[model samples]
Target: MTVEVQLLGGTANQGRVHRVGNTVRRPLRPTSAAAHALLRHLEEVGFDGAPRVLGVDEAGREVLSYVPGQAVTAPPPCWGLTDEALRSVGRLVRRFHDATADFDPSPYQWSPQVPAPFGDGGIAHNDLNLDNVVFRGGTAIALIDFDLAGPGTPVWDVAAAARLWAPLRDPSDVTDVRRGRELHRLRQFVDAYGLDAEGRAAFLPALRDSHRWMRDIVREGAADGVPGFAAYWTAEAEARAERARAWFESAADEITNAVT
Candidate 1:
């Protein structure tokens, strides 16, 4: 059967993605085998939010079920910045984590593995940036772009999500309604995810570490000549990252208070 192809946007990977009927097609990466296995596990466990991998296509691209929803982009709209939206994102991430908890990752060839300060345990969707999520009715519904998924802890994964969705950032760099509500948003996320006392204690510090981790990745990707990361590095990533680091340090007390 012949199908029309539509190019996808909002991705930073150096691969072209296209939509074909009810599925998406993208060039396979070196880590594609691992990502495909992860997706397969998600399907076997009946997790509806993730895409179902359909093996390689005639053109040798990886095919995935097209999750129908709007991908939230940068400078997030007011809807994506709401307290309700923040909670929703947290819950979705928690669900994904729970589903993948027992998945044995030993057989997979995952790449760019994240170093979790807590322990090397659960597999996490390491990159939960705004653009990687799909939203509907002003709420986060599903996550996409699994190329960065790898072994890590729930706290580590949640911390990364909070860094983006709860927006643990320098106020100067934030442009949405979420600008001044970092602490509040962080608390809301913790509450929604039902983090325990110990998890709460570790959350703030984990978030700080995530900032450094992300900045390093951006710099590394740019150095490797990836256009998207290169553009961000050249634009304002350095200054923005430094300021965010300082802000996370200064707000550490407040973040702890909110979550604890």
Candidate 2:
């Protein structure tokens, strides 16, 4: 019998993922079919940065090929916090966007979290949180957890990555080596991703939107009694969210200058 080893990290899937040999088993969601289709399309187009859908398990969970790499979990390892790692993430996201350029998302009902002004240019991973990215030797390799993958623009994806990876949060909240270098790192990320002038121009607004969108998701998840979200939505977390918003407003010009 194949042993089921639980995989840690990620709030939404906490206590749910298990590794059986070289496959991962995850619970099916309303959007799983669409996510699976996206994965299959990525495979069809030869995008190796995502896991391959390996069909369903006997227990009815979706099975995916195990991507062998370390995810940037809490307290983030030294390698995952380097500037090079950030750049690699930017480049990887760009590649993912390019791979989805010709995909037809019209056939799938995606997560309804996609907001306007950044409407469906292509399917985006949407949740590029640090833990979603898998890295080896400090280089980002694959993006997992496609539950939030849906209709989104390339800049939107870039902004989402920047928000989590560059982590445009308030400095008070960033206690690592990345503390004061947020905007500088954000510039490196965008440059690595090779955002065009137009994309750069739209990036700041996208960042603001991305921040609110993610905040709302976490807030809703907590309200709906999700254990991870509930645990994360403490009074301090709420205060940090407000501080992050204020920081964005005050640093808008600096952020704009950095990316431009």
Candidate 3:
């Protein structure tokens, strides 16, 4: 009998992911079919930065190939905080977007939470949070947790990544060494991703939308009493989010100048 090791990291799916041999078992969701198809397409296109979708298990869990790497979790490690790791994330995301360019997502019943005008570019790895990406040899190698994977633009994905990686938040909320260097990191990430001039022009607006999008998800999740979301939706968290919005509004020109 194979032992099941509970995988940690990610608040949304906390305690729901397990490792059995060389596979990962996760709870099936309404969006699993879409996610599975997306993974299969990635494989067909030779993208190795994501997990492979195996059949469902007897217990009704979606089985996937276990990718071995260290995810950048809370209170990130020194290696995960490096510019190299950030650049690697940019390259990985670029590759993922390129691979999915031909995928048609109209048939799949994607998550309804993905707002309009945002999902048309292609099927994107909507949640590119720090913990969602896996790193090997101090380099970002793969992305996990496809629960939020669905219709999205490449710029949207880049914005999500920048929001979390460069962080784009109130400096007071950032206790790490990355506190004052958010804009510099943002420029580094976009440069590494090779975002085109047109994409660069649209990035700041996408970043604003990305911020609102994520905040809404967390708020709705907390309202529905999801244990993890509820815990994270404290007054402090709300205050910080508000401050981030204000900061983004005030720094819009500065941010635009940095990336362009």
Best candidate per TM-score, number? 2
lDDT of 3 by residue, 186-219 (tens): 9999999999997899888888888888888989
Cα deviation of 57 in candidate 2 (Å)?
0.8
Residues 108-148 of candidate 1 have per-residue lDDT tens digits of 78867675574477888888988788889988889898987
Off by over 4 Å in 3: none
TM-score of each: 0.93, 0.98, 0.97
Error of 1 at 256 (Å): 1.2
- Candidate 2 TM-score over all chains jointly: 0.98
Q: Can you give the lDDT of residue 61 in candidate 2? A: 97
Query: Which digits, one per residue and each the tens of the lDDT, describe model 2 over residues 1-260?
Result: 78999998878778999999999999999999899999998999999999999999999999999999999998789999999999999999999999999998888878866789797688788889899999999999999999889998999999889988887988999999999999999999999999999899999899999888888999999999999899998999999999999999999999999999
User: lDDT of each structure?
Assistant: 0.82, 0.91, 0.89
Off by over 4 Å in 2: none
Location of the lowest summed lDDT over 10 successive residues in candidate 2: 112-121
Error of 1 at 88 (Å): 0.8
Q: Please identify which of the two predictions, 1 or 3, would achieve the higher lDDT against the true structure.
A: 3
Error at 162, model 2, angstroms: 0.5
